[model samples]
Target: MLRIKKLDIFVLKSFLLLFCGTFFICLFIFMMQFLWRYVDELVGKGLDMNVLAQFFFYSGLTLIPISLPLAILLAALMTFGNFGERYELLSMKAAGIPLLRIMASVVIFSIFLGGMSFFFQNVIGPKAQKQLWTLLVSMKQKSPEVDIPEGVFYSDIEGYNIYVKKKDKDTGMLKDVLIYNFSDGFENAHIVWAEEGKLELTADKQHLYLHLYNGEQFENLKSQSVISQNVPYRRETFKEKHTLIKFDSEFNMVDGSFLDRRSDIKNMREISVAIDSLIAYGDSVGRAMHAETMQLTYKPAQLSSSDSIKLQKEHITVVNVDSVYNSMTSAEKLKTVTATKNRLSSLASDWNMKSYITQNTDSDIRSHQSDWHKKITLSLACVIFFFIGAPLGAIIRKGGLGMPVVISIIIFLIYYIVDSGATRIAKSGGMNIILGTWMSTIVLAPLGAFFTYKSNKDSAVFNADMYIMFFRKLFGIRISRHMFKKEVIIHNPTYKEDWEVLEDICNSCEQYARTHRLLGLPNYIQIFTNNKHDDVIKDINQKMENTIEDLSNTKDHIILNYMNNYPFLSTTAHKSLFDNRWLNLLVGIVIPAGLLVYLHIWRYRIRLDKDLKTIIKTSRDIQEQIKNQHLY
Candidate 1:
């Protein structure tokens, strides 16, 4: 028996409440997307409330599998994010509860959700899918309600186009209606003019009834069979007219037996059976094609029936194809080549046709296999996404809908694109079904593991300052130096001695610049492979620091201010590219990669060269200042 921990209950309650809210939100979003795809079918058909209700109900059910993974991701992110932001995560860790232990409840819940997703897709999804699409086709087949506008010809009605000069919305009455009837044929068309008219559906809603007051009907009296010298027409004037037109206004639900849902409407057992049948059929086709191709042999027409029959029954000496071709006359050679080309072409075409049959068979098998694997993959996606989101949330330390929403969308989109692309590739036989369907999950699982490891270890995975400092140290980047005037004179300036130290820094800078040829570009090969620290530059930097320290205590403002011009130096700017021999050798061998490193090193070399000049000039200026202050 498992004992219920308060921690587990708290975690489950927190995650589930958010999970339910997120699930509905995600489901509604997916349903809206689903509705948008068929909005054209549903709109203007004047479908009843029950039909619309059923549309959402069935569609929402079908979309549950799609929504579960994303919902789990968002919920996990938000839950852990809230804990991190509120400092609850910190307190829990401080209490010795590990991150994985804290996440244990949610992890189990996500697994359950994943299992539920599989069951829902395998069972409930198929029924909902059939009903939803069936309703969609029925809605698409339904005719739109009549809404003839003023001054416009409505051609929606079959065999007739009606233009109304004016329509009264309150009474559904039309004024100055003109109807063109092309029911019989466009050549023998009829026309009607009405001062006022009203159109209504009949009792069975299978016909349209029209009542027109003060109407005139004109129609061609001559039929297409008759060839009269003068084309004659008939005209009739009446005070009132009643006409019936064939039009169906009732909604009829259709049988969706025509729909192709062989794979989609199947459980694992049914799919396995379908897969087996398809595989067997494919094998039969392959064997038949193989037997057919094996029978094809090039036989010369010049050979007699007896010779051909004899050759077919017995083994013959191996004939040199080259020698045989060379012995043939020009005309015979042409005939032989043409016949061979024709035979090969015929074989190629037949092979292509058979190949297509087998290819399509394989594609069908892949589709079924993909569908079979999708249930398990999507279930696993829920668990994988939870791992991803929960750990990432802990890392980002952001709560509420703001950060979590953006992050969830980005991650979910990545998953969706990879999954969809891989599944398509698999279905098209570009890759194996199992690998393709599981690719996205495989891609994300390691990321979740990394995040979990980082979060559990309390690593600053997202700290910008930490990374910046690391890169700076790695590259030997120089930082800006800040120095200020001190009010208290705990130590007075040794100005004469400091001036001597400045001279020494200047001499060392000139000597190092001369030895290293700092103004010249470095060898491309030597940049990575032979990189070394400049000990002389390090010595020069120490002398400059000593001089700056002494001048910093000067009472004279000019003398003290002059020391601010001292350069903040980096010791290893010209050192090994990666601090490793193997990496340095690897980089040196790659020219394009090596070129970039060379440029970076050269830029630092130029800076060092310029720094040497500044050192000499600044040291002399400070020496002059000390001489004027006479502080020694």
Candidate 2:
């Protein structure tokens, strides 16, 4: 039932080589982007080789989800593009092998790759995500390497500011060093002026030892008491003195247990459990807030048992608060107003606090929900990108890194923008989380389908001629004939026969112009209701092209010149708005749309009338030259 054909193996091998190379390339690019985001944290901190290695390893693992999709896109585009470019695709199709069958192996391989991507994300990605974030947080908290500038005051240390005026790099000696020792609060800060000093880290690397030569120390004994504000100060001179500054220089790995609570660092099961718990918690909070709000509106406990029974029997009351307020004294009114204001403020504060709590809870639930869908969306991205790239590659028929690379970037960029924007909107509660997460895939699925359909049908999806014709019809763009004389004529034109075809085309154009009422306005009703190609125009254009093909080899310079004057005519551009009668009818009923279409057609109609005259004029010129016997 299972067989590995040579064609399947060949396809697999070609794609496998390309995918492997492109995967690493994409991985490196994304890793560099990730690194740049945290470059500020990594730079200046004195981290060890293995620590950096761990960072690199964890980062690469975390980036695989993003990288895999891009790699697949680029690889698929290149693989099929290369095949199409080299005419291998044509050869296969020529052999009666359908495009889908040719692509069957790569599609299956892509699905397998998608599975691998899913497994990697669901298993290894979470651990790597946690470790990488933990490392980044640790690096951000790490102290910078101690490299004091000669003229700047280095204040990176906890409490002391050390200004170095000059330093000897070779012998590790400082000429003028001023140290502001503010370790004992700034109010009681002391100053140390040293003529020359030598600084070194202790063996434990936990303290900076400063050995100074001929230095003076000034200290002010500041006091809180007013009487002691005239403080007593002391100055001492020493030939040799040593001071110890507490500075921990050793790298310490931080505790990353905090990061384990994050959504990104959790597997599918963990995320699911977390999401359920979060949703339950959010619902409980919502119910609590609802109860709190309800308490303000109804308070049954405020009534006595008998009063409650009476109120239950008759839940109706009428009060005139304005009359009561008017009957109160000014003092009583002021006291009452103050009490109500205070009560309202207290309630507002409580409500605001509760609202904040509710918002935070909802945001947390959305985060877990976002991550849950992310795993599936990212896995699906691999398959989605493959479908897009393979079909697009075949349609574009461009190989190598140049065109494929550019196209991949454009497509990937569009996907990234849409996906990121949708995710942000979803996370902010602006859209449904599932739809937002799968936004890119949904938007591109149709494109992939379209390309696949076209490639299968052997359609030129990117054919420039089709688009050119469309715009020309839309804008009434003129077409010109640029006929050049050939030096060597293999088959000279039969002037007499060419004159007959040209003369017939001229007469047909004239007859059709008169019958079609080219000088009058179009019939608006029939223009929309009836759609037909001017057969006379089609016949004339065809004959003109055929005669020109033969006449292009003419030795007569004048006849060659006359052939270039014949305008390339159109059959349907000036006809009913489109071939679809229903669309034409819809536009015709819509007065403004119909009027615009009518105006464009009228312009083309006039142009056609002039073109028909030009054809007659040019044809007559060529006929006169032929009759004169200019060539044999």
Candidate 3:
């Protein structure tokens, strides 16, 4: 049997779980449209198997791109969440492994997936969509659910006024129902009522049944007086109620060609771009959240009401470009030179207004492009999410399904909202193509980075401690290790001084031991410390926990170093680290990759020199760190 480390197993399992979860979720949603939109056509028109299968297959492909990013976003968050919930993230961090390293691997994997998504969107999605529409158009009838609501009266299905009451929990039996069958025999048709009936399942589960216990029948003849008859009905059960729905209930088959025409390349291109723009908008919004959070931290003071009001007023006003033509009177407009000048001025003014709008409400630009933006936006979202996810998972320092699902859902909803909003705006023709496509990514990428940063710094975003506490309460079992030193000291005070001293020593010892990859004080010494040792060690453990907390604060870097080297400062400080070239290469790669991305996005000419210099400095810093480590 092959043996694998727990970490590897966890990563693999998490990916698989996320992948499957996303796939099924997307697939289910895709399938649902058939019931809601097309089932009636198939059943009523008696469409062939090829047409029906083709409809589903192509429809599924058309949805793949839209579904890919959500799937990845959800899956990654879930995978990491599961890891975090299990405290696997904690274990890795405690071992002095950087969360960034773990994220690097996951991100690399995500990029690959992103590429796959893009391929699907470009190659498979468009053609499939055409086929799907063609198949749907060819069908003469729609599915039953399209026209029938369970427990409601409907007159749309064929020539019957049907009502469904109670239904069998498992078998889908309609307990009480009525049907007025009037196919061309409008005035003479009989009305039948049933106490119970069941919907028959075909390849497509969209059929209805009626079983009446007791009811009266009624009929009206066009040429004669109306007739009514009393009838006693029992479980004269209407079994196998297989009824096909017509697809052409609302739409004519002759007109279906126009719909198919509407799904041509031009339409698809528009749809694709719209999706892309929406995805971009989602990322941009995420980035804005990240930026706002950082700004809030850096500048915590509240804005004055006057300033807030001024900003609000500006937000509501639209750019005025029509004024350019106002200067030309009717007589002046007649001159060729004046007319040309006016046209040029108007064009320039329009451009200026667009530029102003872009700068002032960049996020809004994503909303204004067109339907084409969404497809492109959604496709690109897959890539943007990879960057956010890898770092986020690493930061959370916990690996588990539950946390990942929650976090992923939160991130996804945010992305979805912004993306959807952008799409709406685009559809309304209020923004441009580029802005709409990239807005969400631009917004959310930084947010993902900010969260990643927090996670890396050991922020409590994942709330691992809360989970531990909850688990303890749930199982009615307490782990002494989780108890704080102050609590333990208050409970057992006999050797408080010794315990406190030991705690300081242990904190230092743990830090040095981790850095040097060495054992702490000998086992014999630990054993000798005994019951008295437990109290001392417990206190020491508490102090170490405090140190861990302190490490998360950027301001506490000096304190962290001092505390870490306390007990074994002389020995651990002198230990040597491995001079691995692979590590150096990784460092080299991260600097350029991160800087290039940042620079490309912030493409202001004034900042080009400064940005380039910063990139160079970052590269140098990595080299310096590697050199310093070697010297030590």
Candidate 4:
């Protein structure tokens, strides 16, 4: 028996709640998208409520695989984001709990979801897809409800148009009706006009009967061959007339067997079997086509007994095509040329038609194979997205739908675009079906791993300040003043002693600025190759910090303010640009900046000169303030 820990339960409860909400939302969104795609087929069909319900039900089921991965991604992001936002994750880490341990419950749940998604894809998805498409086809084929409005010609019926000047709703009667029937052919169309008429459906609801009180029918008897001749037609006037029109009013379900052979309607096993059969059939057809082409292009000459005997007698004669043509009479030449032309044309047409059929078959095989791989790829996406989302959420330290929603959408869009492109390429046989189908997964799996690793170490992956400093260093941008916290001193004045130390520091800075080549190309290379200036910068920083600490003991606020103006030099200012050796190497290799490197070095040299000047001036200012004030 396994016992669930409190932490696991807490994490699981949070994640499961978000997952359920997001899953249904995603499912509804995708279903709406699917519905919009087939809106034309669904609308105005007067479909039964039960039929619509079944369609939406099946559509929702079919879209489960598509929505599952996105839901897991969003839920995991929100869950971990909430933890990070509220400092719960920090507390956990402080209490000796690792990120991986905290994520154990959610990861298990995501794995279970992935398995469920796979089961749905393999079992429910295919059946739902089949039923949904079948219903759509049936709806498209179903006749529109007879809704003829007055004063407009209604052509909803197969081969007829009806117009009514006025209609009586209560009695279902039409006055001044006109009808055009072209079922025989447009050229032999018949037109009828009635003073009054009534329409009714047949007992079986498969036909319509229209009874006219007084009407005249005109029939056209025009022939295609007699286009220039006078047309003949007949007209008949009747007091009472009845016409029967074939119209199926009942909602009949299409046979599922009609779409049973489609790839979308098959399970993984069926798809695999069908793919194998198709590939085998394609191979056999290719061999047959190759044989036929070879037979046509490389025909062997017949050898009779007489020709064989003649070949053994004296000299062998080689026949040339030009000579053979020249030997024929004019009439024979014409006949031969015409026959050859006809034969070539027939062969070309047959080859084109057969090639087209073979291509269609091959495309079908690729589509089936792609779908088979798609089921697995979509299931795997859930796990991949979970890793990506959870780690990213923890790294960004953002909760709710604000930042996480934006990031999730961006990531999901990238995945969607890549997946769509790969699927298109695979469908067109531009790449291997398996490789193309799994391309998005292949691309994103490493990203998820990288994020997880970075988040586990509590790395500031999205720290704007760090990246800004890096860019500033790269571009050789330096500001005169640095942002620092201000402090007030309340002890008795030690300005005299501190002022002396400040002057000595100023003197050293001035001497160092003149003698040291601290910011040129040579210094840059030396810093990375060997830390030649490390001790000097470290010593200076230590002295600055020590002096600031001693100054904090002074009582004069004026002296303390002046002393605070002297900025402490950073040790990293003269060190290598990046702390990571690998990153430095990568930058050096990728950006072989000859001129840019020199420019950056020149800029840093100027900045260092300015910083030294500023430090010297600040120290002198403090000394001047201490001299003007009377010592207590």
Candidate 5:
């Protein structure tokens, strides 16, 4: 937990970066619709910058709730990804920290952030939405000049297309009116043509009046009386001939828990408490059963009518036989009857036990019970995903937008699709919500654990060295230990042969090469064998030692070259290279300042070589001793 606290700064930074990135991306996409809807209405009205800014700020807050969770998930992926990519995670592991412990901080951060998001969704979001819509309505109605267009037909403002054929320069009166009303459904929908019309403003300027001198309204009235009358009106009044344009569209309010409207904060708290209790109980039960199932069965001793009748029939048959055997000796008859009764009782008991076993194995009860059980399983998905992303970052040991982005997308997509489908099924009341949401996690949790375990145990499952080996197998390429140059053997006498030592050396060299690559060092060195028959154990060890030394020299030389060349470049080019070199240098410094901080690392390695030499000498000496003993 202290370690988790220590990582707060890093976790917070990652969360903020991810949150901002997602928010901006969402803003850019949604802003166009937002601006398009209001831009025309605010053009000539002299809209305040403060109002627009406030609108956007409130809108942004509403958007943050949905965006934050996605951002957190992506951020976690990228953070661990960077750690893995940079080998910082590997370094942590090498220092004796487990991957799960390292992820403790991220999990804590996500939970806290998730809680914040839930709050935002419930409280700030509703207020922001209400304010945004109210402001848009206020801005639209106050200014008529805002909705009027000079040339184009403004149909988008309302359902009718208002066209001005001619206009007065002084009064701004639109003449030769043509109004196309498309709102009243087809056929009844009609176009109004007027010989002369003028635009006038009401006393409040809140309403615009269209005054007509002479106009004929075209309509297909189905009533015979309306068709026969043929009425034509040419009248104009102050308020009678005005269209009250209501630009305000009703907006829905987001009010309550994410899952349910009736769900209050208190209800959520209760639900959380209940969930915790249920999870604890279910987990204990599941462990006891050694399964995730939650069903149990027992049989009552009460017999059904059919069973009673069958027993009665068997008894009556025995009684009838006894009645028929009245003349038989009493002792002999009693003994026969007792033996028969014991056999019948034993058979009935066996059948009852079998029926009880069958009744207890019912899956309907299990499925119904598992519905709630599924929720507990699903609740742990977020934690399991952390398990996957964290250690994977450590294993892949490369984190940047490139790999992290790709991996995050794949993982999140899989999670989202499964979660969504399951939720939909659960909501329709067909399946359990918990099971639906958690099915993806349950399937993937073990897979992630397997990868983490393999990584911790230093398994070569995802190790890049395997690729080289795979390629060699596919291409049938072989490199012999003898073909590679052999170093001079240093002599000593205490060394002894341990065949198992070969596997240990191979694993070490593989790990060393991986660490070197992560540190941005040159060529990885590891043994590649096409044959297991011949032992090249000593040869592989010698080559690995030489390669590691070479890797160090190669990195030092590259650093030296960059440092020397940086002083002699042109201004613009120099700036570009300088920026890149500085980043690289900062990254490179980790290898020496961090990995090589212990002088004993070098000393211990040197001791390994001396021990190997001693083992060789001791083996030769032992062989000589054995030969002399045989001669004696």
Candidate 6:
């Protein structure tokens, strides 16, 4: 058992607060998206308060798996980012706490959260989905509220089309109404035209009552005679008329068990059972089909006793189809050919249908398997995203919703796109369902690990200056001089001593350049083997630093500029012409062995040559300046 320290408690408290806030925020966003997708089923149903409440409750539950991982990512990012931004992380590091140690509490908490997420997915998620969909189905089945719009045909009522030219909102009266009633049958439809009408739902909400004033009803009458060409019709004029239409506006819940058979609504055990059952069923069906096909193609003939006796007396003979066809009449040949074509066509159609059904069943099985893997993969995503987010936050050192939100959304979108694409491929049986479902995890986990490793080392992973310097070195670009504020120095009488020190430094650089043989293949081999050159460079850098400290009070800008060039000289020595044995080895092992390696080595040599020349020329110029200023 591990004991929690105060620091751990502090870190966890901050993380928990952010996690809770982000979790609810994510959940609400996901719930809104869910509502948008199913709004059609939910809207205008006049659902009861209890029904609506249950829907929202289940919807939130169902969205937990999706929202939880995103929340963890954002919260972890924000928490660590704030620490880094405020230099709290630096203080913790200075206290001898490693990044991993600082993260241990949150890592443990993330694991616990992942476990809970799994539980929710396996247990609560299915129940919520079942209930939510049950309510949705009920809502879809419930009739819409009666609000007839003017200048449009209203067909919400079954088997009837109602049109209102104008409606009075205050009086609840429809003006210039036209009703086409086809509930009895299309041939017996009744068309009613009314100057005004009032529509009301029955007390039980089972039917609609329409009372019309100054209305005319036209009904098509059915003919008793089958041969009757003209149909009889009836027209009735009424001062006021009332009619009842069958409409069930009551909310009715469907059975939740209807969706139980879906794989998404099952736990791991249930999913395994379903996968096994599906595989076994598929194999059995394939075997049965194969056996049936074999039976059809080469079925054993049943012989009677007389036929067997005849066959025993005579040898069996083979018939040649071509010779038999040649001997047949033209009409007979045509008939035989047509029969064969029709038979082949019928068999092909039957086999095609069977293949289609098999393909569809296999696709469905893959989809279910993918969903089964998704249950575990999504839970695992929480831990993976936490690792990624925490390390990334430390690297970026940005807090608040601005930068963190942008980065989190971008990463989540990438994960979603990859997961979705792989899922589609798995559903089509183009890839293994397990592999497809875990593709994003496989890709992102290594990235998280890399970020963790870098963060632990306090690497400048996101530092633009580091990458810029790298590119500059790779391209053999000249190092830029560092800028300093212009200032006047009072003392400058040590010019002769400075010249001797600069000459010594130049002699040391020239001697290293000559002794290392930096221009040839020996330089390449030296990169792989450690030599005294690195130590020599370090000594020279220390000497340069001491000399610069001695000349700190120099007033000469020329000497100051030459001193500034010391950093460039040190950099050239630090990144010697030949270094990084692994890179050399890799380049050597490639197909064109040493082609790229040779180019790089040449670039380094050229850069070193230029840096040495600049160092020598700048030292000579400083000496000339000292002599010209009569400082000796």
Best by TM-score: 2
Whole-model lDDT values for every prediction: 0.85, 0.86, 0.54, 0.83, 0.52, 0.83
Error of 3 at 497 (Å): 18
- Candidate 4 lowest-lDDT run of ten: 477-486
Clashes, model 1: 0
What's model 2's TM-score? 0.91
Report the backbone clash tally of model 3. 99
lDDT of 6 by residue, 120-237 (tens): 9999987787887888888888888988888999999999999999989999999999999999888788999999999999998889999999989998777544247877789999
The Cα RMSD in angstroms, rounded to one decimal, for candidate 6 relative to the true structure is: 4.6
Off by over 4 Å in 1: 1-3, 182-189, 220-231, 260-262, 284-360, 466-479, 484-511, 521-533, 539-564, 578-599, 613-632
Instruction: Please report how far candidate 4 places residue 369 from its true position, in Å.
Output: 2.0
lDDT sort, best first:
2, 1, 6, 4, 3, 5
What lDDT tens digits, residue by residue, belong to model 1 across residues 1-632? 76679989988999999989999999999988888988876788778999899989998888899899899999999999999999999999999999999998888888888889998989998778788878888888888888888888999889999999998999999999999999888878889999999999899989899999998999887653446667778999989999899988777889988765457777888889999999999999999877776665444346778967776788765556798799989999999899999988997998889889999899889989998998888888988898889998999999789989999999999999999999999889889899998899889989888888898898888888899999987666657655667888798877767778878888888888888866687877676776466678888888888777766776777765666776788667765677787898898889888788778778788888888898899889888877776656
Give the higher-lDDT candidate: 1 or 4.
1
507 Cα displacement, candidate 4 (Å): 2.5
- Predicted candidate 4 versus true structure: per-residue lDDT over 199-263, tens digit per residue: 88899989999899888999876654336476778899999999899999777778878887688
Residue-by-residue lDDT tens digits, candidate 5, 538-610? 4544543443333222222222232221111011210111235444345335665424322322333343334
What would the TM-scores of all predictions be?
Answer: 0.80, 0.91, 0.41, 0.86, 0.44, 0.84
Choose 1 or 6, whichever is better by lDDT: 1
Instruction: Return whichever of 2 and 6 wins on TM-score.
Output: 2
Ranking by TM-score: 2, 4, 6, 1, 5, 3
Pairs of residues clashing in candidate 2: none
Better of 2 and 3 by lDDT: 2
Better of 3 and 6 by TM-score: 6
Q: lDDT tens string, model 3, 1-632? A: 53555665557666866678777786677678655785545665445576556666777777777677767776666666666667777787799877766555556666776777666765676567666665665564443343346777877666677777665667655667777777657656766665555444344343333334445555554555445464333233343343443323232333334543232323445555554665676667557656855885699445589956875888945434365346767775568467678978986886576555445444433333333445555666776776566556655644555555677778788887886676556545576555655678778978877877787887766577878887854433434222122212223222233334434553444443344322232222222122121233344445544443432232322332333332211111111111354543343357665344323223322232232233234333323433454422
